[model samples]
Target: MEIRQLEYFVAVAEEGSFTRAAERVHVAQPGVSAQIRRLERELGHDLLDRSGRAVTVTAVGAAVLPLARAALGSVESARRTVEEMAGLVRGAVRVGMVVSCGVMDVPELLAAFHTSFPGVEITLTEANSDELVSSLVDGRLDLALIGYAGPAPDGLAVRVLADEPLVVAVTDADPWRARESVPLDELLERGVICLPPGTGLRGALDEACGTRRPRIAFEVSAPPMVITLARRGLGPAVLAASMVPPDLHAVRITDPVPSGALAFAWRAEGPHSPAARALIGLAENRVTAP
Candidate 1:
């Protein structure tokens, strides 16, 4: 019933261990367990089932967790609003970014935002487009830089930042290094090192290749790993043109120039904090390439 109780519950639920949650929240383990017991008694239902050092949320816990999270978020937002009124632009902004965006846009955006608002705390998480979208919807991220795909989330606003063309990255010693541009069909036959599903660029490549089915020799999750694998002559990788590492050479896909847009998205219904607004402004202005 108390805000503190909800906080403890959420911490335990997320960490899945009472000891870990206590460590994270800087509380004694026994204190955390006592609080949880008190909370369950007040709610008249068990929230978590602990067995053999593993914990799982009970049905009632699953039902209440989201509501508890929302309540805590609201409380934090209110505190932030008051702090803002006192000329203190201090609040955490959680950002979810695709790997390509992390390489291409995040550094500049972070620099600009930090320079402009030093007091605002920033937390960045790198994830694929699908993970970013899901995190944004679940209130884990304040905003996300993701690849443009189908319809936006029902109540979210999206701003397209850049359209990054797809390119084939290969080792300098590879035979494809001699080519200025390569056909999409030819590249497919040459084998492609692709990112696993859920990445924005991977989805774009899939759409572009259609039924041709590029031979995937290896699947990598990180952009740098993909480049490293390609550099070792594992195979060519499909990636945003801007994400090609300096050491690697990239060839344009000429037959069908596949590309995807990078976008900044946030909840349309929620009030935008000053820090969030400032970050968005920076992303819009600084994301353009020279």
Candidate 2:
């Protein structure tokens, strides 16, 4: 039997419905049935027991199911291998970055990648670290520059670009500006402008808080806004040590100081698109922390 017929048979066996199998294989239901009949004729045996409401595979069908799946998998693997050999010549890469990502120069990296693989189309999206990780898991993103706190995400290949302490920033007019460091309890006592929850920065802050809850004055997605509002004397801002403005007084968090980590990540398992593989290789070769 032809690969198409085998494919249809496998789909039917797995889906247990000719209509659903036809939809999955993008063929008409009648066509799928005809093909399966032809396959059964060639094999000289009935592959499925369709007398019941739910289709069941016959003994011979069960025996051939794994082989059919293996054949399809082999073909797919071969296609991916060839595509990867072509590098980023003809494919799209969906990339993600955390909002206000300043740990590494993402634009510069993208520019370099484009220069090298001019044929590859690149798309960029911005979101929180947690959202980015979720997108990666769901196959919506090919790669991401995400901020993570605590442990790295499960089933993701992570290359850390930056890991630094979280600091509290205040204006010169603030009473605690002269202090060398601030405790988590003391920092939470004042109005704090920080990154919203569901972000790596927020995770770190929350971990540091432990049982205590901080009064968040303003929850912003943009990192620069945190410093801007604090500098305006609105409230104290919590941000990465490196993100703290040069003019603002940055106080280290003394008790259980939280730290934010920025990383480049992709799916640890599964086949990567050609452009995704190329970009990942390029990033690995030329990752310099800012």
In terms of lDDT, the best-performing candidate is 2
Q: Where's the lowest-lDDT run of ten residues in candidate 2? A: 281-290
Residues 38-100, candidate 1: write the lDDT tens digits. Answer: 999999999998875777789999999999999999999999778664432666688988874
- Which pairs of residues collide in model 2? none
Backbone Cα, N, C clashes tallied per candidate: 0, 0
- In model 1, the Cα lDDT at residue 194 comes to 82
- Tens-digit lDDT string for candidate 2 (86-193): 766887899999888766788899999899888888999999888999999999999999888888998899888889899889888988889999888788888789
- Give lDDT: candidate 2, residue 167: 88
TM-score of candidate 2 on Cα atoms, chains taken together? 0.71
Please list all clashing residue pairs in model 1, or write none if there are none.
Answer: none
